[model samples]
Target chain A: MVAKRIIPCLDVDAGRVVKGIQFQHLKDAGDPVQQARRYRDEGADELVFLDITASVEKRKTLVEMVQKVARTLDIPFTVGGGIRTLDDARAILSSGADKISVNTAAVQRPEFIAELADMFGTQCVVLAIDAKRRLGRGNRRAETGERAANVESDIAREASPTGDPEVWFEVYTYGGRRPTGRDALAWAAEAERLGAGELLVTSIDRDGTETGYDVDLLAALAARVNLPIIASGGCGRPEHIYEAFVRGRADAALAASIFHFHRYPIPVVKRFLRQRGIEVRP
Target chain B: MMTRILILDYGVGNLFSLMSAIQREGAEPLIRQEIPPDPCFDGLILPGVGHFTPVSERLRRMRSAIDEVIERGTPILGVCLGMQVLFDRSEEGPGQGLGLIPGAVVRLPDSVKIPHMGWNRLHLVRSNPLLHGVPQGAWVYFVHSFYPQPEDESVVLARAEHGVSFPAVVGRDRIFGTQFHPEKSGEAGSLMLKNFLRLCRG
Candidate 1:
């Protein structure tokens, strides 16, 4: 059996890793390469560098950072964010990233999934789905409380078999701020059909909250897609990882804040998972 | 003595990390679209991670150079899709392979989930230089749905079970192939590459 992957995500802002990165003895969490090497050694199955600074020239900055990280680590590295064109994908992969994750670009141009799969092989392309929980009767995007009256009919809303109004997760774009009025489950099914090898399903409501993974959402998407599903966002504890694998049935779990702040180093997390028979890679 | 390794980039997959890994093992790594007219590298590396058909077309263009290097008995190591292209054909693609080795690439059994994208334990089928410094049952990273089934089983150097028992490593004389990406396999991978470098220098 393949071991369940434990991944730590690094949020990159103009080539530097940020977001709760300072803590303990690891003073230099700013350098992406050093953090990458440390995580790789600490038993991270793969590392994701999410480029938050969305700009034209920052793409080049992301590429340069990928080159540096690739030189220092042997583990699989993934780059996400601001990749809108094939040229953007090309520049990043050529710089040595093992995979590139696309969210808004893939949603805007769904054909972009197959195009990437056709050019770089399905294994190197990861489709990122930012899902927000729909918790009310109002037809609006989650968190924003804005009206999505016109776009409501665009996504199917199934009433529960018991006849009560059902809640479904809607896919969000542009860092989960803009609503696409599309169900993430439907999008995942289409993404697999479009040749995406993996799906990184993130719960926007749970992101940066560390309440725990939206296991309910993760479970829902995992059942819908044939590709490997990486559960991202709201992972504050090692038990969250265990739940993602055993309960949510996610192939991998990704966390950022806890690891960056040194609350739980990767090796300790792996050990925790292994003790519970999660079959994590050492 | 340093070993010079030529990495053939056919406009498919990532090869930068592979190049850096070779350099870390104390070898000179060079990348080119095609085999140079007068190639001087001690070893040849074919690294890829995409569909085998396009890679087969690219290798078809460099057939003569590849054959000449084989005739010269220079070491060649193919990784992942690079390994699959060494065979005569693959079920994943339409085109035929280089036919350097007598074999065909087939998809892993449906019983297992693919792309087999995780770390697996390698079971050595037979003794080979590639496993020189590596331990028995060492864990290596793999990310492919199809594995090569060599016509001559004697060429199979190591086996890793996925759904069907598949060959993880294959070799015949100076020619070799690894289904997993050694460049990403960490210490065990570095040891394997270092051993390959030694053979190239020898």
Candidate 2:
């Protein structure tokens, strides 16, 4: 039986691990390789390096960072952000990225998903969808500072899968700063059909909030797709991880802040889940 | 003597990770994209990625060169698409594989995910030097859809279940194949590489 994976998403900017990743033996917060190696030693099943700085000038730095991380860590690593075209994906993969995540680019040109999948195996392509719950009447913008695009009128809003009007979430791009107006669950299904190997669903409203994962959203996406769904956003506690699997039925749980701040070491979290009877990779 | 393992770079798969893993094991990695005239290396590693036919096409011209190494009983280890290319053919794309091993690479049942990506535990069905010190149920990273269905069942070294019980590790004589990427599978994978290096030393 495959065990549920616990992943720590490391944000990379300007060729450096941006945030302070305080592992039990974290040598430095700036060294992505050391931080990743520490997480691997602490029982992280996989890792994701999100290149927050997707500038053309920083692309070369990110590629080198990917190679360094690949040589330093043994766990499977996925690189996301700025992977817009096939060449972009190739540059990362050839530099030793096991899998790549395409968010805005895939949403803009839906065929980009299949094109990358056709080049690399589908398993190597993970479709990252940012979904945010729509409030009663406000559609201001995402606070994540991502660029906004006027895609709200592209698709008509459908009935929420849960059949609750207040529960509907619209898909967003550019780090959840822009609303694409696409139904979150509907768009996730479409990505899978387009040959996405996995769905990385992040709750824009809950992201960086660290209250807990959006269980309702994850549960809905998990129910709609057969592929492995990784529940991201709002994991403030180890129990939240357990809840993601038990309640959301997510195949994997990804958290950034909790693990980044050393609030709970990955081994401690895995032990907590294991004691609670979740099959996690030891 | 440093065990030298020749890694084939068919212009399909990236050899950096594989080469780095080999170097970490204290073995000399000899990489060549072009087929060499002599199988002078102590062992051979076929590291691959991409669709079956395109990758297989890269291996076609090097078939006779590869066969010469196999005929010499030089230890060879193939990972992912590299492992699939050892089979007679594949369902992924049209074309014949190297046919070094007797089997057809078939698509995994649709009941499970296509790529079968992630870290899955291995159940050792039989003993082999490649799995020397590795524990049973040791987790290894897998990322592929098709698996080799060897005509000879005894070739299976270990098995893992997704939708069905598929061969995770297969061995025939000195020819070995791991459907997963040993270079990326952490400690357990490193041990497997070390074991393969030991076989090369012999």
Model 2 chain A: worst 10 consecutive residues (lDDT sum): A19-28
lDDT tens digits by residue: candidate 2, A94-137: 88888899999998888899998888778889999888877532
Candidate 1 regions exceeding 4 Å error are A20-29, A136-165, B37-39
What is candidate 1's local distance difference test score? 0.83
Worst 10 residues of 2 chain B by lDDT: B8-17
In the range A189-266, model 1's lDDT, one tens digit per residue, is 888889888889888888877888888888777666667889998899999989989888899898998888789999
RMSD of each candidate?
Answer: 3.6, 3.9
**Per-model TM against the reference:** 0.93, 0.92
What fnat does each of the candidate structures reach? 0.60, 0.62
| lDDT by residue for model 2 (B1-202), tens | 7788899876655567888899989999998886577756899988867778887888897878887887788899999888999899999899889887899998888777566878899999999999998999999988888888999999999999888899999998999999988998889999999999999988
